[model samples]
Target: MEGRVLITGVAGFIGFHLARRLLADGWTVLGIDNLNDYYDPGLKKDRLAQLEGHPAFQFQKIDLADRSGMEALFAGPYFDVVIHLAAQAGVRYSLQAPHSYVDSNITGLLHILEGCRAQKTAHLLFASSSSVYGANSHLPYSVHDPVDHPVSLYAATKRAGELMAHSYAHLYGIPCTGLRFFTVYGPWGRPDMAYFSFTRKILAGEAIPVFNHGKMQRDFTYIDDIIEGVTRLIPKIPNAQAAWPQDPAASAAPFRIYNIGNHTPVALTDFIGTLESCLGEKAQIEWLPMQDGDVVATYADVAELQEAVAFAPDTSLQDGLQQFVDWYRRYYG
Candidate 1:
C-alpha cells in the first residue's frame, strides 16, 4: 500500500502526523503547503522541521490556489495517491474573510480536481468537515444526511467542495473519498481551536470564553485517531457501485464520503473540566452567547467508517488531553 503520495498541507496538525506515518511506512511523500499565517507560521515551520530530514520526504512551498504551480507539480510526478488537506480553515474567520474560503476551499479544490483528472490518480482523498452537517438537528450526523443548509460561509464552501469532488468523480471516473472530520484536537494542533486557546488562557489565569453558556457539545476526535482512520482508508479506494441507492454518501461512480469522528459527544462544560484537571488549574470562564457560525453540538455516526475500515476513534477525552498537555508543557517551556 506504500507508494508516492502527494499530501497537501503537510505542516498542519493532521497532515504532519500523516506524513510522518506514511514516511515511516515506506511511502515517498511530497508534501506542499502555503505556510500561510492564518495562525502562527512558526508552529507550521516546526512541524515541517520534524519531517524535513526524512529520506523519503520532500517539502514544497506551493499554494493550492496557484493553478500553474499545481499544474507543474502534477506534470512532474505520477502520484499514486493525493491527500488534499490544505484549506483556509476556520468557522468564524470566514465571516470576516469570506473570499478566502472560496479561494482555498473552492478554487483550490478545483485545481486539485483538475490535476487528479489529468494524472488519473489511484485515489483522491480530500478533507471535509463536520460543519458541513450544518443546520441539521440530527444527533449523530451521517454522511447520508442532507447538507443543503450551511450555517456559515465556511460550511457552505465545504459542502461545495464535496459536490465538486463528486462531479469530478462522476465525470472523470476518479476514485474520490471525502472525509468529514469532527472536532479534531491534540498536540501540534491548530491554535485557532478553542481547546488550544483555552489552554493558553487558563495557564495565564485569563478568562476563557465559554460560548453557548457552556451548553454546547462536540465529538472531539483525537489527532492520532484521525490519522489512523485516514491511514486505513488510503488503500481502501472506492469502486463504482453497479446499482446506486440514491444515497448522498455513495454513488455509482467511484466516489464516497465517511464521517471520521469519535462518535462520542462531550458537553462543553465537561470538556473544560477535563482540561482544567489536565492542566491542574481552574479556568476563569467567561460565559458568552453563542457566536455566529457556531453549532450547538456535533456528534458523528461513525458506523459506516467502522464498517468500511473496521476502525473508529475510541480515545477518551481524559487520555487525549493529558497527552496534549504533556506536549504543550514540553514545547512551550
Candidate 2:
C-alpha cells in the first residue's frame, strides 16, 4: 500500500471516484458511509459495487457523527490522508432538512477532527462548496474573499466545517485543505442536481425546470476534473503561514482553501440546450423564479489552486454534459 487513506462518503459521487483513483494509484483505501437514502441507495450501492472489486479498497457502513465509531476507526490505525467528503449535500434541500446538515456536516466533522487530533494525521482534505460565497456579488469567487455571509444552512455548515478544521489544524497541527467545489456534474452524479434531474426529465419528455427564470449560470465542473484537482491536492499538504499577530484567516494554522471549479460559467438555458443536443431531443422548458437557497451565478477563480497544484477544472460544459447524458442513458437502461 502506498498509504492508508480514509474517505468518508465513499459511496458518494466524488468519494467513489476518489476511491477508484486512489486504488488505481496503489493506495489502500478505507471508506465509510451510512448509505442513507438521500438520493438513491441503489446508486450508492452500485458505486460501492465498483469499488468492492478492488482488493485495496475496504468499506465500513458507519456514520461520521457516530463518535464512538469514529474513535474506534481512528484508534486502530493512523491514516496518511483523511478525505472528508461526507455531508448532507443540498442547497435547496437544506430548507427542509436543516438538522441533517447540522448532524452530518457539523457534528460529523467534529468527529473527523477529533480523530485527526488523536492521530495527528498527515493531511486532511474536506469538501467545501462555492455556496459559501453567498450573495457576495463577486464576479468569480476567490479563496481570498471572506465567506462570512451564507444563504443556506448547507453553505453555513460547510463554512462551519472549514472553521472547525482550521481550529483543529491550529491546535493539533493537522494539515488541512478545504476544497470549495463548484457546481460538480458528470457520470454517477447526484440525481438531485439540476443537470441529472434535467437529463432525466428530458429523456422522459417532461418539462425541465429552469430556475431563476432561465438566467442563472453555473461553473459546471466535470467529475474527472474534480477528482484530478482533489488527487493533486492530497500530496500538497498545508503548512501554517501565520505568526501570532498575523490574521488567522491568512496565516491560520495549516489551513488553506481552494476553489475547484470550471472557470467557465455556463448559462442555464445554454446548458439545457447542450444536454438536449447530447440526448438528441428537445426539452420542454418550465421557466420559474429562483428558489431560495440558490445562487444566481457561480464562477470560480482557480488561480490559487493552479499555483498550488498546477491544475484547474477545464472540461468544457458540452463535453462534460454529453458524457453525463451517455452515462445516464447507459446507467438507467
lDDT of 2 at 85: 97
In the order shown, what is each candidate's alpha-carbon RMSD?
0.6, 1.4
User: What digit string (tens of lDDT, one per residue) describes model 2 on residues 1-333?
Assistant: 269999999999999999999999999999999999988999999999999988899999999889899999999988999999999999989999889999999999999999988998999999999999997887888887888999999999999998999888888899999999999999999999989998888889899888779989999999999999999999999887756435423555888889999999988888888888898999999889989988889999999899998998888888998898888889989
lDDT tens digits, residue span 1-333, model 1 = 889999999999899999999998899999999999999999999999999999999999999899999999999989999999999999999999999999999999999999999999999999999999999998889988889999999999999999999999999999999999999999999999999999999999999999889989999999999999999999999999999999887799999999999999999999999999999999999899999999999999998999999999999999999999999999999
lDDT of each: 0.95, 0.91
Please list the residue runs of candidate 1 whose C-alpha ends up more than 4 Å from where it truly belongs after superposition.
Answer: none
Which pairs clash in model 1? none
- TM-score: model 2 vs. ground truth: 0.97
lDDT of 1 at 157: 94
